[model samples]
Target: MSQLGKFITIILATSTLALTGCASKNKKSQVMVAPLGVGHGGNMGGYYGGPLVNNSDAIRNAARNIQGVVYFDFDSDAIKPEAARILDQQAQFLNSNQGARVQVAGHTDERGTREYNMSLGERRAAAVRSYLAGKGVNTANIEIISFGEEQPAATGSNEAAWSKNRRAELSY
Candidate 1:
């Protein structure tokens, strides 16, 4: 073959290879391939997978205004009197942020059976949800999830830990 023809062939091959490489790289970056039994369509065990809950600026501001999570007594599902003020603030925020939805996660200390704790956690979440609904927040926008004793705000088995665990977390 002529030198010019050979060079042209080489250039064409290299250009083709480069273009293929670029396409592959673009696909790699843009397309996320989840492993088997993962992603949105797959069953991620018992847990639901979706967007991470992020508190809106309004919700965060409201939470900050209220101070912090309210505590409940051991094995109780009732929201304490002190928590009413915080719930009131949260209710106001929910009422104002009509487009936002919230999830109330209930947790408990590692002191009871997993099943019992799960029930307790659910009750705790229900208590919070009921309070918010009573305060004029729409029930449709609020969800409840019970973590039971699986998740703990404080790890210790002491009073402080138990106190922190026996509460509901508001997420949006």
Candidate 2:
């Protein structure tokens, strides 16, 4: 081979080696979670950093269909009667799925002080938690986190937006 050809071959080998090393390093840094269900597309469906949920698409769809998380009138922690039906469905799902764990995240609209909003969020989450616990779901399997007014589902100052922001979201 000519000198130029030898130089190009060396460069290609070095590039290939560098790419291989980087790939191996990434593999070492990765954390793996055991999946609970098969993916619909036959590929793993969970994100890398977040917690891996059981990924029962049917159960997920059912949970999504139930609307437990609700907006209350401003500065109130009362659970509406309409919201109760949704929670009842969630309670049933949890009761049936013995191995499942869930996190109830409570959020509030930006109409109050941050500290006050945090307390309000906690109250809302606790209310749901208490209701679920009352419905024979294990208290240990449920975790509650209150984000207060820090994370808004909607980003506007109007009542319409604020109403949307105040809610509890369930995640597994």
Candidate 3:
């Protein structure tokens, strides 16, 4: 291209960024991640680091469709036996990639108050975290967050939707 064309392209890009406050066009897929300490069942509430979650396209693509999600029953935080297989897979993936980190997001159906749902979400996330830890994944590479009822997986107030909503998603 000519210099004039290159100049115009740069100008347009700068104008768009200035108007939009420098936001990227990509969609964000996970929550903020804090690093954890390198130990299990510690005195630090079992958590161990950070202000943000930084992910590369390579890591994200590698973890894509790895079936790292575990669902839960309505109003329950217990890890069901059927979920063990996928949880073990997730743990193995993480253990193999020592530098890779994953975020565990807990979600609940809109069947209870916001406060109650939030607590349930936390429990669900913790349960998943514990399971991963037991499977030999480093606790330091796992971060947890609770989305509660705010981010339902499915719309509507039906059994199908509720069942889909009660899940914990692992994002790397």
Candidate 4:
């Protein structure tokens, strides 16, 4: 090879060796990240310097204890007295964890038309967002979605099921 060709070849060889050496020696140590679910994506959780643990079960269990649910009255988006207390606790949580985000999902009973129920659900979610904002929680961190009557807490046409259905759920 000519002088220039030999220099280029040497550079390429060095780069290949350096890159290969930098590769992880243990194939088993490689981490495979699962695809993110629906919403504004990217690693919103930020970086964790520590080793990752598969604590999904723990998270699922602890989620039940987190009181982020608020019930509403029939055909009303207004925050009920009982719901206000629940919201207050949620507000406290959000206030303490400023970086935490929440998804407010509104649900309605199977009574009104799909369109009407969807609108009502949106209003319910908006009301919850407003209440949280009032309680010093950052509105920017809150996202609202209306599921309407599609996903009912209790499947029935009776008042008992209807009452359970009308609510907004907050998920972090």
User: lDDT of all predictions, in order shown?
Assistant: 0.72, 0.71, 0.77, 0.74
Q: Name the lDDT value of residue 143 in candidate 3.
A: 77
What is candidate 3's lDDT per residue for 1-172, written digit by digit as tens? 9999999999999999788884556744233322233332432212244423456778788888589779999999899987888888888888877778888888899899877877788888888988999988887778778767767678898999999999998888
Each candidate's TM vs. the true structure?
0.65, 0.64, 0.68, 0.64
- Measured on C-alpha atoms, candidate 4 has an lDDT of 0.74
lDDT agreement of model 3 with the native: 0.77
| Residue 93, candidate 3: C-alpha displacement in angstroms | 0.3
Q: What is the lDDT of candidate 2?
A: 0.71
Q: Which of 2 and 4 is the better model by lDDT? A: 4
- Residue-level lDDT tens digits of model 2 in 1-172: 9999999999999999987775433432111222223242333322233543454666676666666466666887777887778888889989988777776767789888777887787777777878899999997777776667766777788998999888887776
The alpha-carbon lDDT assigned to residue 5 of candidate 4 equals 100
Top lDDT hit: 3
By TM-score, who's the top model here?
3
User: 83-139, model 1: which lDDT tens digit per residue?
Assistant: 898888888878888766777777778898877887787788888889999999988
Q: Say which prediction, candidate 1 or candidate 4, comes out ahead on lDDT.
A: 4
| Colliding pairs, model 1 | none
Clashing residue pairs, backbone N/CA/C < 3 A, model 4 = none
